[model samples]
Target: MRYPIETLGEALAEGIVTGHPAMPQFELTPPEINDLLSYLKSLE
Candidate 1:
């Protein structure tokens, strides 16, 4: 899924590691990461 930011830091912190090589180029912020977690949680 795409995040608000453009970094993979947030996704990695959340244990959502992706095998895609381009993932490293993405940039994500703390708040945006939090939002991603919240959204992911709702999927449960």
Candidate 2:
């Protein structure tokens, strides 16, 4: 479970200003978070 803390941090920061309704509020399990991070990192 290795999420890119930075990505979550950035999302939180951006959501603060944009007030995005899609922004998630709950904490994700380690595996789910890691999977998302892996997907995003691969896009780079």
Clashes of 2: 0
My TM-score estimates for the predictions, one after another, are 0.47, 0.44
**C-alpha RMSD by candidate, in order:** 7.6, 7.0
Q: Best-fitting candidate, measured by lDDT?
A: 1
Tell me the lDDT of model 2 at 15. 40
User: What lDDT tens digits, residue by residue, belong to model 1 across residues 1-44?
Assistant: 67544454445566665778776655557777678767766776
**Which ranges in model 1 have alpha carbons more than 4 Å from their true place?**
1-24
Superposed by TM-score, candidate 1 places the C-alpha of residue 10 at a distance from the truth, in angstroms, of 6.1
Deviation in Å, model 2, residue 15 alpha carbon: 12
**Regions of model 2 farther than 4 Å from truth:** 1-24
lDDT of 2 by residue, 1-44 (tens): 33355667455344434357685555556677667767777897
